[model samples]
Target: MKITFLGTGTSLGIPIIGSKHPVCLSKNSKDKRLRSSILIEKDQKNFLIDCGPDFRYQMLRSNHERLNAIFITHEHQDHIGGLDDVRPINFNMNQPIPIYGLRRVIENLKKRFFYIFSKNKKSNVSKISVYELDDYKNFFIVENYKIFPLLTWHGQLPILGFRIENFAYITDASHIPFQTIQRLKGINILVLNILRKEMKHSFPFMLSETLKITQQICPQKTYLTHISHTFGFHEEIEKQLPKDVYLAYDKLIIYE
Candidate 1:
């Protein structure tokens, strides 16, 4: 399996509008993050997680040719804003993209992108099929990839994090339930969201809280994503974290 960090910044992304923060102004390309999103590839099939607002640009930059499915964590605008851009892929690939998420998320997509869900809509529009998911469900999405859903809390919203093979990816999660923590044990790689040094947002984790959780989970490697400019320079933050933890940047790819 191969995991690609398509984008690792928060809702506003790094280098927020009109801000002259040093991290924002840095010339390092890694510092210039888009919104948080990721792609998982197993065999020849591709599964995208959280098609955020920067989805189009990220796809173009990565030269993505096709997407087999989309897994949503929640219904936040930043995550779903780029849903419409999947049109070209659908047209070119000549197939409907399977979308998996919670029931509420499916409902939100139907209402938000009414044209796609319209019963008598034109055929040219992208075809998207929805599959509602539940926490703790373990099932095969593709021939070789079996996924387990881990239910977590992002403030009031119920976010569905995923465990694929040896990797666990969770974002926009504020608190993971005790049962989910049990499922996350023995992960080779774990990715969690840490918006800023502190907990100012309804979603995302406080740095200290995340560190404590990591210590307990004890994954082989733990990388933090969904970061904001407030998290400070990547190199500086890297100095503070333990050797096993890392700050993920856009375009980082991992394979096992």
Candidate 2:
């Protein structure tokens, strides 16, 4: 299995518009992030996680040739905005891409992108197939792999985190339930989200809280994503992280 960090920045992304943040002004490419997303490849099949607004650019940059499915973490715009960009894939593959998400998320997608689902939809509209996920069930099969959905909390909203074998990916998460923690127990590679350094909000994990969770999960290796410029420069913050934890940058790839 190969996992690629397509984008690792928060909703607004790094260099937030015209902000003067030093991290944003840095010359390092790692400091420049698009939005949060990832590409997972196994058995020659590619699966995408969270097609945020930057999806098109990320795919182009990576030169991706195939995408079998997309697993959504939540209904937030930063996570689902790029669904429309799947048109090219739909055209080339001649099939609607299967997208898995919670019931609310599927409903939101239908409501937000009604044109895509409309009976009178234009020929140019992207094709999509919705798959409602039930958190209470065991892992489900997709292509050549089994996917387990981990129910987690992103503020007051319920979201999903996915577990495939010993690799788990979770983003836009604030609180993870005890049961979800148990599900992640034996993960060898854990991808988590840490929005910033401060803990003023509960919508996203702060650096301190992320560290505590990392210790508890105790994955052989942990990669932090959904980062913001507030977390500081990629190199500087990296120096502060524990040896087993890493700050994920766009395009970073891991193999198992």
> Using TM-score as the measure, which candidate wins?
2
Q: Write the per-residue lDDT of candidate 2 for residues 1-256, one digit (tens) a residue.
A: 9999999999999889999989989999999998999999988899999999999999999999578999999999999999889999987788989999999899999999999999996568988999998754588788968999999899999899999999999998999998888889988999999998885775999988888988888999999999989989899899999889999999999986
Residue lDDT tens for model 1, 104-215? 9999999998999998987667688899886455654654578788899989878888888779999988898988898889999999989789646666787987898888
- Superposition TM-score, candidate 2 onto the true structure: 0.97
lDDT of 1 at 83: 86
lDDT of each: 0.87, 0.92
- TM, every model: 0.95, 0.97
Model 2 alpha-carbon drift over 4 Å, by segment: none
- The whole-model C-alpha lDDT of candidate 2 against the native structure comes to 0.92
User: How well does candidate 1 match the true structure, expressed as C-alpha RMSD?
Assistant: 1.5
**CA-only RMSD, every prediction:** 1.5, 1.0
